[model samples]
Target: MSCCHAASWLSCARLVQRADALRIIRRVPMPGYDVSFLITAQHLAGPGARQQLVDWLVGFVMECDAEINGLKLDINARGRAVATSLLRSLAF
Candidate 1:
C-alpha cells in the first residue's frame, strides 16, 4: 500500500507545470500563495545535478503542500541563465 496521497500530489504537480508555462509568456497573478526560491547554474554544473535538484523540489512541494503560481529564469551579468525563482507573487 502506498503511504502517499497520489491524487493531490498529481494535482499539485499539474498546477505547478501549468503556472510555469503561463508564466513563460507573460506576467501572472498569484493569489493566496507566497513561495519562491532560486537555483543557480553553478549549482547544477555537474553530473546528476538536475536530478538532485528535482528530487529536492519534489520533496519541498510535498512537504510544504505549496501552491506555486509562477516560474522565471534570469540571465546574470556573465550571460548565464539561472532559475531565479520558482514562484513570484509580487508584481514585476
Candidate 2:
C-alpha cells in the first residue's frame, strides 16, 4: 500500500486542471492507501463565487477519492502583500 498526497490551486475557470496534471503521477497506483489533497484558492469573486469554487473543489476531491485534510485560501488578495498577510495569519 502507498499513500499519495497532492496539492493544487483552484482557479476561476471551473475546471479541474489539477487532476489532469496529476494523471501522470497517479498511474503508479496506490493500493489500499489513503490519498490526501490540499487545495488553495486566491481572488475568489465574492461570497457566491467562493461558494461555487468550494462546490467545484468538493466535487473534484470526491472524484479523486482523496481526503481533503487542509485548505489554504487567499481571498480578496491582489498581490504579494496580501499573500504575505494570509501566510502570516496561517502561521499563528
Candidate 3:
C-alpha cells in the first residue's frame, strides 16, 4: 500500500476508538510491495471493546479491498496474538 492508503487506514482505525485515541505503533514497507502497519486502540471502552474494534477493522479492510494479510493490531499491549486470532477468524 502507498503512504496515502496507510494514512487512510490509520484514520479509519482512529474513528473506532473513544479514549486515548488511536496511535500508529509501527510502519514497515515491504520492498516494492505492500506496506504494513501496527496500530493500537489507545484507551478501550469495555470488555468487548477490542473485539468490536477488530470487527470494525475487518469490515474496513473488506470495504477498502485492502489485502490485510499482514495487518497487526496491538490492543493495550496484548500484542500480535489477538490480532492474529482476529485476522485468522476473519479469514483474511
Candidate 4:
C-alpha cells in the first residue's frame, strides 16, 4: 500500500478519498484508535539483513496508538466545553 494511503487512513476516523492525509492530519482531531504502517521500497528488502526494520515498525505502532487515545480525550473535552457553553447561554 502507498504510504500516502496508509497515513490517510490512520489520520482520521472516516475514509477519505483522493486527498493528501498528511495535510489533513493538522485539522482533524486524531481518531480514537491510531494504527499506521509505512513500508518503503527498501523495507521490503530489509527482511534479508535489516531485522531492525521490524523493531522500528513495532515501536511506531505503539506510539500511534498512544497518540490516538490522547487525541480522543482532547476531542471529548472540547465537545463537553461546547455543550456547556451552549447550555449556559440558554440559562438566562
Task: List TM-scores for all candidates, in order.
Answer: 0.33, 0.27, 0.31, 0.46
lDDT of the structure predicted as candidate 1: 0.45
lDDT of 4 by residue, 27-53 (tens): 334456343334456544535534555
Cα lDDT tens digits for candidate 1, 1-92: 01134434675565466435323212332444355444567557779867766766676566444322211122242234223342243436
Enumerate residue pairs that collide in model 3.
1-34
For candidate 1, list the clashing residue pairs, or say none.
none
RMSD of 3: 16.8
Clashes in candidate 4: how many? 0
- List the lowest-lDDT window of 10 residues for candidate 3: 17-26
Question: Candidate 4 clashing pairs?
Answer: none
Candidate 2 lDDT tens digits, 22-92 = 32224334666444343344425356756665666577656444333332222233466778888999995
Error of 3 at 41 (Å): 10
Q: How many clashing residue pairs are found in candidate 3?
A: 1
Candidate 2, backbone clash total: 0
**Top-TM-score candidate index:** 4
- For candidate 2, the TM-score is 0.27
Each candidate's lDDT (Cα)?
Answer: 0.45, 0.45, 0.49, 0.49
Arrange candidates by TM-score, highest first: which order? 4, 1, 3, 2
Instruction: Estimate, for each residue in 50-87, the C-alpha lDDT of model 3 and write its tens digit.
Output: 77567655665664554332343323346667787899
